[model samples]
Target: MSIVQETPIYRFGDFTLDVTNRELRLGEKRLELNARYFDALALLVREHGRLVAKERFFEEVWADVVVSDSALTQGIKAIRRVLGDDAANPRFIQTVPRHGYRFIAGVSTVARDDTAPLPDGEAAGSPDAASTPATPAAGEAFPSPTRLADRGAAALATALATALAGTLGGAVAGLFGGLLYGFGLAHAPPDPQPGTASILLVLITLSGFLGTMGGFGVGAGIAAAEYAAGGRAAWRIAGAVLGGMLVGGSVKLLGVDAFNLLFGRTPAGITGGMEGAALGLAVGLGAHLGGGFEASPWWRPVAAAAATGAACGVLIVLAGGHLLGGSLDLLARSFAESRLQLDAIGHFFGEVRFGPTTRMVLAAIEGLLFASCVVGALVAARRPRNGLPA
Candidate 1:
């Protein structure tokens, strides 16, 4: 019998681990994973189905960083979920009471040509000491230790780009909205309080618009990161947006109540909680459905716009009953008693009612914002420099 050394590529069950690309593919679909989890997986595979101790994982994976055993537990759970393995009757990974884990599945080293073309434009340099002898398919090459670092860099870059794109989009929207209201272009306020009215309105409008833009952009950035990490773009977008809204809403509710209790002043309207929950549901559904247009380059933007507009309508109606027939008495009362200086507070409080034209404009703004989010996400998700292995 001849001894075969370890290889960068491994095939076990229906999964293919392209260590070079740092990806785990099931046939054609690529599974999403974090860098740390992948590192732990690669270590286990390298050990050739042998038991990997918890202490060893900490030394290698964590590298002096203090963490609890739960981190490892979570990583194992994530691996199982991706591999569709059950803890009770495990197939791939089996836990040893309190000792460690063992890779029970059979692993085969994939033959490869180290001199083949690298995916990320790296030169097909000489193979290192770890190179194993084998005949791999065309375009397959062994991944170096630097592959993990490169993947991490790519993730960071994507996040930064998404955040920048979102900030720019929000700033533009704020400038436009602020100019319109500041110059007396929009509906005039009910009680224009002297020389400070326009300045106050512009500042307040810019602040609120910027806040909304920032929040949505952060959500979109999260979705963009998810897509960059090989997740389904549509589902990620919807999930990220909905999750962000719900969280933000919850914090807002608690913060408002806390502030009111501390200072004896209401910070939010009565329907604020309802508005957040409802808006979260509506926006999430809209993003989820609009993601279907991803295949069509032209219709994708249109879908995003439509979804945004719909979400906006729902939000407006939920917030203060501006779109449909609903009472705004609570909102009005909150505004009257609250000390907060908000832009167009009268309109929100039902003092300056929104006509059909005003409502349509608001909806259009929402649509534009949604479209901007799509653009931001796509911009960050541009063809990755180091694409998945062929």
Candidate 2:
């Protein structure tokens, strides 16, 4: 009979241990595991889903050394810790008293390419290694590991580029609104968390995404078409969307207090801070997304805004009434309080009819922001260096 050595490749849950290279990975982080502990893990994975006697372990793992029971126990503990395996209720390595260990866990197997030295040498190169091996289709790996790294680096660079594009685009799209407000294109309170900065932010961000997708779609689609997945454009668009949302909300917080002092009037400390934050996020997102000025509740863009605006209106009416007069007139005064926040721009579009002055102002501001966002997104999308996987 021929002896076939299992090349120390095993996976269970969100983990993989390469015995040959003495490496381990949990999620994405690779660990520098002790040799003995690594050996123990390797043995367990090789005989996964079966009982492995303790004597067999001693013979196979500790053939040269005469180690005490404590040494073995320590090694086992170290292995458990590295694997995040619980002794009480083992998730990876199972314990059996007066016997040995068993790895009764579900594991997906992949044949190691023995032609080359196990590519786990460099810790820094682990992510690139991990990403390449899991391609959706089985065909062939690229030219070299360097090529793979280049692809990953490109992907990350693209992500950052998209973020920057959204920020720049969002600013441009919202120039009109900012000018109208006499704040020179300011977002809500700059001290804020993530999300859209205002209705303009949302519209601009969305429009930018759409425009960039249309402009970049041809190139991205061409790139993606080369691969098995038929959604490169979609992925780029998704990145733009995510990047716009994340960047837009954060970037606008740079001068929120200044904007508040000049054009924003909310000054109630924490409450006002939160309001400013919400407004900033709303505006940032709307500006970056760069969609149309939609106010119809049924429309996806307008509907999303209306839902948020409605909730804000309801909360404001109730909270305002509670804070001011305690009359609980939420139903009656919801609209009056809601039409002023950065988000109210959506609610005022086509969905809710208001006085001429208010509607006209809202329309002009949204139209201006929307135009800028679309232009920015198109500029980004049209650029060839957009983050597309090679």
Candidate 3:
């Protein structure tokens, strides 16, 4: 003969999971859930707040069986389906990246004695009159991917896109600035010499490298926002763009200020911080708004192009003043040897002249180049895959 007892119940929100009977109920109604899923949910609820590693899931849920990872994923998906939880925006379970899962909701426990029956007037199907239900927290909970490898791949692609954009932005700035410098030289009365041209080429290349770094900061911000806050398309894009601008601007202004403070000299000039902030702001806004598609489009080539172009344009304008200075040593050597015949070089060095007209021209050229390259790359990448919107 065997004696049966009422099981202990674990309560969270409106659901009560009875371990003794292996039943889960909402209010007075019982919900049909698979035993395996129930086991996984029970474990999650038990360890609430702490991440349950995948290895532990196998040991505890599958009893150390060499099961595929898909088993755990299916179990989790089933649990979410029953709970009406969104994996993109979870209300109960949160997936820990590269790890297992965590139960974020609060829980309480109740124990019942089966030996003692209820009072004559009490009903078994009614809500638990003896227990006080803890008030569940307001709003939906965050959800992440059950698979780490998938998210990791997305992260890598986002990172690569940002880096490439930054580098391209820098290259555009340098190339245009060099062109403007050469154009200004061409109109001068004296013909420019080889040494001056070589020096300017090196200076232009250096400018491109620096511009690339500045653009990279904005890219990082966009990626971080997307990964951290999963939201509606508008919210994600807005948040990402805003975050990118803030980060980009901060990178430019603060970096320059730091160098000035440390060196006891302002190498970027009095307006360097202002220039950096402007560049950062433009990059963020252009990149976020350029796509003009849904708030959260599957593809973002247009936006990338716009952002890269915007960043390149701003940097090229700000970097115009650096053209002649960068080539000073080479110019000096050439001048000493009488190898530089251009009177324009002498005037440029003496006056430290960089005109606004030239800067605007450079901006237009660099911006166009950046936009074309980024857009082309994005379109090409998407072409092979079918069903994507044009």
Query: How displaced is residue 131 in candidate 2, in Å?
Result: 24
lDDT of 3 by residue, 1-390 (tens): 976544356666667777657888877799987666787887787666678887667545544122234456657877898878888998679988768898766665555644233444333323443233322222102223443444456545644554455546545554655555555565543455556667566556645554454444444444454445431234334543454355445654764677568755334432233343444444444434543221124246455655565555656556652222333333433335544333463354344332354444445444545444433332343233211223
When 1 and 2 are scored with TM-score, the better candidate is: 1
lDDT of 3 at 157: 62
- The segments of candidate 1 whose C-alpha lies over 4 angstroms from its true place after superposition are 1-142, 178-193, 196-229, 254-263, 267-303, 315-364, 367-390
The count of residue-pair clashes in candidate 3 stands at 3
Clashes of each: 2, 46, 3
Per-model C-alpha RMSD: 13.0, 19.6, 14.2
The C-alpha stretches of model 3 lying farther than 4 A from their native spots are 1-149, 179-190, 230-273, 292-353, 363-390
Candidate 2, backbone clash total: 46
- How high a TM-score does candidate 1 get? 0.45
Q: All candidates' lDDT scores?
A: 0.50, 0.41, 0.50
Candidate 1: tens digits of C-alpha lDDT, residues 5-60: 43457666667677767988887799997676787777666664578888667546
Model 1 weakest lDDT span, ten residues long? 121-130
Per-residue lDDT tens digits for candidate 2, residues 135-211, read 21111112356655654565444434434444454445344434443231133343222343473464444334432
- Order by lDDT, highest first: 3, 1, 2
| Candidate 1 collision pairs | 111-136, 112-136
